[model samples]
Target chain A: MKLTCTVNGLRIEATAEPRLLLVDFLRHQLRLTATHVGCEIGVCGACTVIVDDEPVRSCLMLAVQADGCRIETAESLAAGGELSPMQASLHAHHGLQCGFCTPGILMTLEALARSGQLPGDEDGVRHVLGGHVCRCTGYQHIVDAVLAQAR
Target chain B: MKPPSFAYARPGTVAEAAGLLAQGDGAVLLAGGQSLMPMLNLRLAAPDTVIDINGIAGLADVRRDDGRLRIGAMARQAALMRTPAVGEALPLLALALPHIGHPQTRSRGTIGGSLCHADPAAELALVAVAADAVLTLLSSAGTRTVPARAFFLHAMETVRAADEILTEITFPASRPGARCAFRELARRHGDFAIAAVAAEWSPEGLTIAVGGLEATPRVCAHLSRELAGRPFEQAAVVRLIDEELAQTEPLEDGVIGPDYRLQLARVLLNDCLAEVLPP
Candidate 1:
């Protein structure tokens, strides 16, 4: 099947099997490897990405299913050469170590930020960051970084 | 893991979608795909054809008229949370919406999909049965409305024929002064419940449903009738729930044993009743 979608800011046209997952299409076909696929059943947020500005489990969506949608991967954050505000904040707050899940977390928070739902405080940030599991950084720095962006 | 290869079709109208479904060569309707996609990836389901109905027109609106709330099947669960009308007019939905997976999953999970999926532990399924909602099912043949109790046949099964699609659901509005409450006990904030309960209570009567207990959400019809005339004493209600649990064969999900579920169901029933019923 031929899949056409807007990714990051570019229009992409690619051929894929009907069963190809959106995450694989981005990582393998589009060469956008930032969106990791972990716990492929949609429980983990490692596959999270923005589809039409809404955060979704890319592992749970097919490339064919997203034929005409707008998608944003973690690569979009650094598309301009310099770190985006969120990327910089995550670094400053020490929000990552062995960052396999960073891209998905970043995209999830990015969607929240886009929606103006970034929490103003630590607890509020944790509340909104539910369902995302972070095995590293103890989540405190992630909350701190998210708070910085929220402010 | 990737899903097995399949043919896909995006129909622009429900009639076209139904027509395609009526063709039925191992065809499965794809709505939000939050649940179905995972199953596909796991190869638990591999329909030869996936009929994508998200493109279908007139299946994503929510409206209120004639003492009921009509929610189109394709409307996302997150959309329901954002709708002030749902929160203001439907206490049961407002209470249950936040518990259907996390906000992220809710963004793409549709109400119809969840209800049609009919997981025994699904909040929407249990809530609809407790509320006695009605569903509009369509196919190339025509349309039929199935009440919530009749809609769910068993765990992960519904009365919906292989060729039919559930298009809309009408939830009867709660009567004035009615107290509606929902509670679920899960391992985490968004995990499937170990035990869950929903209740609609008023001076007139009681309607209650318990999830994670049986093959389907168990509406305590006998207990609801008993509570209609029974006093609001916590002890009495607890005893009544225990009596009902005695007759039920709770389904064990490996997470908890049936005995634990019965106790948990009793605990949830108490908590839910405390919120809606007088001391």
Candidate 2:
């Protein structure tokens, strides 16, 4: 199947198998390897991406589903050599250790902040990130990062 | 994990989508794909064709008319949560919204898909039952509205025919003085519920719905009758909880035991009742 969609700010097209996952297509076909596949299942938020202004698990979506949609990945958060506020906040708050879950968290948080629907307190930030699992950081710093951004 | 090979069709109209589903053997309708994608990857479901319903028009609108809230099947959970009418008309659904998968998953997960998937532990099922929502199932022939009570047959099972597609869900708007509450206990925030309860109170009586401890959403009509016109006393509440728990038979999954789930159901039900009852 030939699929075409805008990744980040660039329009791209590729012919791929119908079974290819959007996450794998972005990483393998487009060579944009920032999106990580942690739990091929939807349980983990490691495969998060923004599709049509909303966050969705890329691993759970077929590459064909991305047809005619606007997708934003972790790479899009940093443009022209500058980091997005979400990326900078994650770094300042030490939101990542092994960095496996960082990309998913970043993309999700970016969408939340950009949508102007983010919670206004620390506990609210923790509640928002509860979907993503991180063996490291204990989520204290991630919560802190979101809280800092909320302010 | 790679999904088994299958033909994919993006239909421009609901009629075309329904036609494709009817013509293709073992065809599955794809909405958000949050639930179907996992099954496809695990090879638990290998449909011969997938009818992508995303391109179908008029299936994503959430509106209200004639004292009923009508939500399109493709309306995302996040979109439903953000709708002011949902919070105003059905506050229990708004309360349950934060408990569904996180912001990301909820942003793409649709109420129609969740109800169609019919997970025994899903929060939406409990809400639908508590609110007495109506599900509209459509096919090439026509459409029919099935009450939530009759819509779910068993775990991951629904009354929807293979050729039919779920179109919309409708429920009476919440009364101005009605009070509703939802409670669930899971190992983690986003994990499947160990036990969950939804309760709504109006001038007429109380309605209670339980999920995650049975094959389908169970309505405690006896308990509701017991609480009618009677003040919510501790002894009465305890006896009602005991009776409800005694009637349920929870499955023993790896996460928790049936006995533990029964106990948790009682505790959560009590907690939910406390929220709606006045001191």
Candidate 3:
């Protein structure tokens, strides 16, 4: 299937099988490797990306389904070659170690920030972080990073 | 890790979607795909044709109609959480919405998809059974409405025919002085519940529904009848729930045993009752 979508401000037109997941379309076809694939079954949250301003599991969505949608990946964060505010904050807080799940977490928080739904406090940030499983940092640093952004 | 390849069709209307489903070539309707996608990736479901219903018009609407809340089947859980009609009119559903999944999943998971997926522990299914919502099923032939209670046949099963698509679910609009509480016990905040309970009390009566107990959300029908429109002590209610639950077989999963599930349900039921039936 021929798929077309705007990704990280780039117009992408690619051909993929109907079963090709959006995460693969970005990582493999579009060469946007910042979006990592953890558990393809949607539990790991490493596949999170913003589609049409909403954070969704890209692996759970087929590339064909994302046609005509506006998508944002973690690559969009540091597109300017300088760390985005959230990314910089994550770094300052040591929010990531292995960083396999960092991209998805960043995109999830980006979606929340874009929608002006970023929680006002640490607990609220932790609540939103409940969706993403971070094994490396124990989520304390991640929560601190997101809270720093909110402040 | 990858879904099996299949022909994909994006139907512009429900009728076309139903027609594709009626073809009997192993067609499956793709709604939010939060549940189905995982199954597809895991090779649990391999359909010959995947009918994408996201393009269908008016399937994502939420509105109040004639003293009832008419929610389109495609109404995403996140959309419902933000919808004023849902929050103002369907308190039980509103209470259960946040527990469905994480924000990312809820942003794409549809209410209709949740009910149709019909997991015994799905929060939406529990809300539907608790609130006595009515569901509208559409097929190539025609449309028929079924009360939520009659919709579920068993775990991950429903009376919905293979060719039919659930189009809408109508929940009773909120009544004045209606108090509701929803509680779920899960390993994580967004994980599937091991035991969950929803309680609603209005002038009309008290309705109790529990999930993760049996093949479907179990409406404490007998207990509801016993407590409806009447005031009762907490001890009496607890004893009643205990007796009712003791007679039934609780669902047991690898996460916990049936005995523990029953125990959790008992505690949750008590907590929910305490919230709405405060002393």
Best by lDDT: 3
A54-82 per-residue lDDT for model 1 (tens digits)? 88999878888888899999988987699
lDDT of 1 at B231: 55
> Where is model 3 chain B poorest over a 10-residue stretch in terms of lDDT?
B223-232
Interface RMSD of each: 1.2, 1.1, 0.7
> What is the per-residue lDDT of model 3 for residues B63-161, given as tens digits with 9 covering 90 to 100?
889999999999999988998888889888888988888999999999999999999999999999999899999998999999999999988999999
DockQ of 2: 0.82
- What tens digits encode model 2's per-residue C-alpha lDDT throughout B1-279? 779999888999988988887785789999888799999999999998888898888998988898889999999999988899999888889989888988878887889999999998999999999889999998998989899999999899999999999999998888778889899998888888988999888777788888999989898888877886566688889988898778777878776889898988889888888777654
DockQ of each: 0.75, 0.82, 0.91
Ranking by TM-score: 3, 2, 1
DockQ of 3: 0.91
Q: Cα lDDT of model 1 overall?
A: 0.88
* Residue B150 shift from truth in candidate 1, angstroms: 1.0
Q: Which regions of candidate 3 deviate over 4 angstroms? A: none
Candidate 1 residue spans exceeding 4 A from truth:
A121-124, B229-231
Ranking 1 against 3 by TM-score, winner:
3
What is the TM-score of chain A, computed separately for every candidate?
A: 0.95, 0.96, 0.97
How big is the positional error of residue B123 in model 1, measured in Å on the Cα after superposition?
A: 0.5
Q: What residue pairs are clashing in model 1?
A: none
